[model samples]
Target: MKRRWLLSLMAGLALMAAASAQAADPVRIGFAISKTGLFAAGTGSQFDTYNFWKDQVNARGGLDVKGVKRPIEFVWYDDQSDPGKAVQIYEKLITSDKVDLLLAPWGTPAHIAVSGVVERYKFPMVGDSAASVKLRELKPGNLWFTTAVMPDRFGPVIADALKANGLKTVAVLTPQLPFALEVKSFLMPALKKNDIEVKVNEEYPPSIKDMTSLLINVKNANPDAVLVFSYPADSTLYMKQARENGIAAPFQFVMVGATESWFTKQFGAATDGIVTMGHWSPKVAAWKKAQPFFDAYEKQFHEAPDYLDSALAYMSCEILEQAVAKAGLDKDGIRKEISTETFETINGPVKFNGVENATTPASLLQIQGKSMELIWPPSIATAKFEKKPAWPAN
Candidate 1:
């Protein structure tokens, strides 16, 4: 009888241990993104998308962990698009608030600024920026990740698109930012390999208000195509000025114009012919997941999304969901889960190539009548390239 009583106690203790092990904690994820300054336009869209995904996941009974579910809660701070402030907020989330996960800021400068803090604390953070190859050069820790495509690989995609269209001579303009410059550096080498002559190359200040002089120089070069790389406001200014100056070229592509919707709404027909590299255009195959987000975003915010950055931020939230589900709401567990990606996202099958860059395929995109279309990489493309029927018509 004593032996039987001891067995019962042991079983009770074992059951208690099992119950203790499966107990869940409220998952608190933190985000530090640009809400002001130059990157605000991009980050604002990003923040909306992130919240959209967060709500969607929570509405579906939160994240599925093994066999149970837990709701997600996030603590966010506005980096204001300032690198220094980004660092401060990041520390606040990790050290003070002790959030379970960290989401980094937008833009390369801001990402680089706070990367060291993440590395030191060893907390998992996926940001909207850090697409540069340099981000991967940092010391290895499972704590950092991003969904931003490498800006360096993007140069080759641009060259390929231009080459396939039989354009040999082109003009390039880049903004004076780290990622933009990295794009130019990589693209110039690829253009050289393809024997594509760069008739004109120019760099403009980050926020060039009026680009009359620059447009005049580009017109003088008279290249067959032109590639413009700049931040949103500057990119918009350059395109508007290019049209006003009557510098028509057969092919005009905007490198960072993934947020083509914003520009098209403002520029109308002038935004018609711009070609861009997009991560999640409404036309890509992955839009199956994105369409719902897009519809909800437009209805709620009354604005179409800036695909690439917005998608990056949205996926950051989803990443948290997956990590929390696998790691059981602990930082160490979540960090391990993040280090290994096993599913596709709204942007398609996603796995971080390194701490800085993601390996998702690029979608070549164009604007068509208030909608964005995917035109290249045929398998995932939603439409064929239709040359802009206006000014620079072939």
Candidate 2:
């Protein structure tokens, strides 16, 4: 009788331990991001921000899943910057790997590509690193953009900003990629509305090695501002050639990439005053979480986060974390939660209308000294718009 009682006690203890272990299972979140190819350089902000969010959550005991807590285990793959590859990877993560949740890929192309996969699988995902008018097609649910960088709003905000700063004419150098083209499409009309002349309008292929010719044309036109609708590689190229070629425009705005730490590291003070498309900056006191995230990211990576990409990446995670905590990993529940909730992000409040972010205003950022500052729309402007300084003679 004594031996049987001891055996029963041991069996009960073992069962309790088993239940505890099962309850603590890691929540597997899966994603595919550009690890190589054209989009690789831009992925660090997004990929690292996701990991940072994971580490921060795990450090605080783990993600709250309704009443239970679980450590996050990322099940990830590289998409090589191919949209088709991104779509394939998501399908695999859902159907084969069976991840509990999904995160987004790195750009407009990838987001638009994976939108179908999420919709088909009935999986809800919050996306960063993408902005386009095309995202409006993925209506009503499943995927949501945390970025307010839609080109339709972006174009007019820039035109208005330029007009406000006393710029009458501009040279527009656009790349043939989907995002840039969309930006140019709306910007032209906004420029007309603002009565800003497009003194030099040039379109280059994404693979173009040289922008010396374009810059020369821009120089000859001698517009008040030079706007290159460029991605990272060409953004770098523009800085290098613009310095060497001396494409001096008082107002210089590269549609993307100026806020990247590498841009400043490479160009030093030259990166200062170069405007870029972004809404978030650590300097904004109103965004209570903004500076803390900046400090944490810099502490972890020993490099500043990309103001646009990293901030959006983190905001996407925050939105997802809140959704999971409330909805408990059920796909339909998570979808409904995300669809209805207004998430507080480092970029400010994010609420989705269809696939677009409705609450955050379309805003612009400029690299000012060692900081990126909001300088648009007056209401959220951290600092007034300033003219880009002359390129340093090397």
Candidate 3:
């Protein structure tokens, strides 16, 4: 009986020790993305990067959760490109699903809508695929945008770039949307400051399928530069119509779609010298991680990532990963770390000031030859700006 009792105690001890050494459960992070509807074209890169980041983390012994390593699992829902629906989905992720962390949705309106949900629950979210000057007004603790392209400064940035390049007059065609309109509001004022004459100024709906009339107006005005403040859907429309209408502006800027890799692939040689929005580029030697990320993403996805949204998404992920490593799973602790520390990202060191990324400047990207290169804010520019060559007659 004494011998039997001794053996049983040893067995129990071994089993408990084995159990303790096993890995902890995955850290469940949740988000809502527009898988269907209007914003879907733009959402592809942001959504892909979120999953890519998750895969990379899991491949390398999981994420460090305050020194305790745990794999990441995502609980995401499609918001159908509706802000109201995005709000409802986030509420479910927090209250019902009880996810440990939250990621942002695509576009300004959705980000704005979901901001309230995160705030009400005091759930911290690092924003991706979103930005606005109005973001400055929101309470700083719960939400912070990863992008520096807040509309308040975007206009001035462009106007400054054009002035530096010796472009004299411009035609501005803005979309009827929160972010685009805000850009127009500031850009018009900045143009006056620069003494650049406006030959044309127009606004169209986000759902607009025809830009023939507007393109004609732009062609008729024959300004030195043409600015089409367009989202993806309307961007495609404008590009097709502009080419057909024989728009001759040497400097042409289509706000959103041109930055994505698909935009270049589809337009091919026609894409050269077109300016759009973006800051980070793999060609920049200053940011150590930029090239590696570009190579790794192209390898994994079989294509180049979106210069604007993909960089923002991955950068936000890097910030959150670092914050988690420092502060663990506690909401308040993670929030504190993100707010106070500077994170090393592909965009270089990012430090937050209130709800905005205070480090990187508002910069514009021009698709030159085959790659997107920074053309604005000469401090970070990868290449000199090139004039838009005449479109080939199709």
What's model 1's lDDT at 350? Answer: 62
- In Å, residue 73's CA in model 2 sits off its true spot by 0.4
Give the lDDT of residue 211 in candidate 2: 91
Listed per candidate, the RMSD to the true structure in angstroms reads 8.7, 4.8, 5.3
Which digits, one per residue and each the tens of the lDDT, describe model 3 over residues 121-196?
9999999788888899899998998898888878899999989999989999988998999988999999999999
- In model 3, which regions exceed 4 Å deviation? 1-23
TM-score of 2: 0.94
lDDT of 1 at 4: 100
lDDT of 2: 0.90
lDDT digits (tens) for residues 1-394 of candidate 1: 9999999999999999898678655467787877777878766666677677767767888667654776667899888778899888888988899876666577788878888888778776666645777877876555354444476777787787777777899989888988888888988988998889999998988877888887888899988788888777777777778777776786777766546456777777777767776757654544477777678777877888777777777767667667666776566777667767654566765676556445667556777656777666666667766655555322
Residue 229, candidate 1: how far off, in angstroms?
0.8
Which model, 1 or 2, shows the larger lDDT? Answer: 2
**What is candidate 2's CA lDDT for residue 161?**
94
Q: What TM-score number comes out for model 1?
A: 0.86
**Candidate 1 vs candidate 3, TM-score winner:** 3
Model 1: CA > 4 A from native: 1-26, 65-68, 143-148, 257-260, 286-288, 356-358, 391-394
Reference-based lDDT, each prediction:
0.72, 0.90, 0.91
